[model samples]
Target: MNTRSLLHHFKEMKHYFIVVVLVFGFSFYLGWANSASFSHFLKDQLAGLETVSKTLSNKENPQVWFFIFIFLNNAIKSILIIFAGLLLGVWPLFMLVANGMILGYVLSLQTNENTLSIVMKGILPHGIIEIPVILIACAYGLKLGMLVWKMGVQLLVPPERRTASVEMKRILHLTKPLIVGMVVLLLIAAIIESTLTYWLVHL
Candidate 1:
């Protein structure tokens, strides 16, 4: 991709990228600095995760298992929603909101497990890059969705004059590149969530 095309791609995903920043920024300001809440958040997240892990009865290698779960949980669904939303932007909103809630809840634990610095250890290394990528993917998905919406509105209104077939073809072209970008993104996120998070929490 040339400079102009790259800029255009970023422009298309501006909204979602903005949302990612806002969410994490809000989280940091509200929860990360608070001593009590941060402690509670870590303990609660671990406790809840422990229960879930036990229910599955796969208690083989805990560190590895936790990493797998953490990375898989966010990455898989995030990728799915992004891909699906190429045709329907609304789909990823559900994933984003749901994941946001889970993140809020997890970060909000605020228990005594060294939650303040720990969260940083868990997030900053990989999250810094991965999150923006996720946001961009989501934005692209939403943009694609808007194309469909624009056509639908045109159809509902007067004469469907938006030339959707041409737009649809263009959207398909965008999908391949977008998916590649998102995959690279999620891979980084998984690595951080799995390896970095584990070490941070453990040590």
Candidate 2:
């Protein structure tokens, strides 16, 4: 990213990071709260079981084929997230929240009975990239969505205001570049997350 883009990104990202830190702190707090509960032990066991199920499911498929599928899915999800931004302001917020909740739950569960280093080795390598990319896409979509609705309040010629065709074409023009850039970034993240990151943790 250029200096301008970098600055713009940080400006956009700062609030989101605040939310993330809150989620992180929340996870740690939840872990402590659950320390004495049977619920904690149960949920931890369930998470482990789910992880094993996922592992077995992966074992049934060739790794290359799985990665190919994951790559396509990542692109599709990014596109949907971007497009969703155009319609609903809170859609991206929902997407980000869902992502955050999963990570939070995982982190909270980690405190039940596992080494921090092991958890980091397992999660952070690709997560460091993948999570932020998802958040960024959601943020961009949120901004775009906000603009689409807010910009519609004023009309230049009353009834002869911007036509649907003109507005849609303009939105497409702007959205194309973001979509392409997001897809490329997501693909790179998928590759690192799927192969390199997993291997680092398990191998």
Candidate 3:
């Protein structure tokens, strides 16, 4: 899609993005206020995530390998989120909330000033780019879900008035640029996280 069309798509989907952002904030607050209970409830799932986090935290991996790992991990996540949107958008919403809660719980576990500093250093460098990209991806997922819903609604209208095909085309048009943009952004984020962020944290 051209720049104008891309911009229009983003503008049209602003409300969906806002909804995801609100849901994320609400989930974060819930996690922060009830971290112990929430953590206990999700202990099994969290354990696996913790293991992966620890592995990624180590600086021993070569930059290229680390970059590849990060990029692939994020790319897979983005794709999954978009696909989940096909399920009436429920999965994307759940993923957003789960991620926000996890972030809040992790931040809450930092008990000391030194630990907080270390965590911030490790996250902030690449997080500035990575987090926003993730949010945008979720927003796009929600948009797809909305499109699915619209298509369903249109199917009920008279054949002459129905515009399902047009909606489908619009969805594809928006999705193409969104996927491309997200991939490029994630690649940049992976490079920053693997190289610069790692160096900063270790220093």
Task: Return the top candidate by TM-score.
Answer: 3
Task: State each model's CA lDDT, in order.
Answer: 0.63, 0.62, 0.80
- Candidate 1 versus the native: TM-score? 0.67
Q: List the candidate 2 regions with Cα displacement exceeding 4 Å.
A: 1-61, 112-115, 155-171
Query: What's the C-alpha lDDT at position 188 in model 3?
Result: 90
**Model 2 scores what on Cα lDDT?**
0.62
Segments of candidate 1 deviating more than 4 angstroms: 1-7, 19-75, 86-88, 111-115, 156-160, 163-165
Question: lDDT: which candidate is best?
Answer: 3
Residue range 59-144, candidate 3, lDDT tens digits: 56667667888899998898789868878888888889988888777777777686568567888878888888888888877877
Tens-digit lDDT track of model 1 for 70-102? 567666765666567756687766545434544
Candidate that beats the other on TM-score, 1 or 3, i.e. the better one: 3
- Count of backbone clashes, every candidate in sequence: 10, 0, 0
Candidate 2 per-residue C-alpha lDDT over 59-172 given as tens digits, one digit per residue, 9 for 90 to 100: 755455546666776778767876787885567766665555555455655544575765667667666766666666676666656667655754534665646446545555
RMSD of each: 5.2, 5.9, 2.5
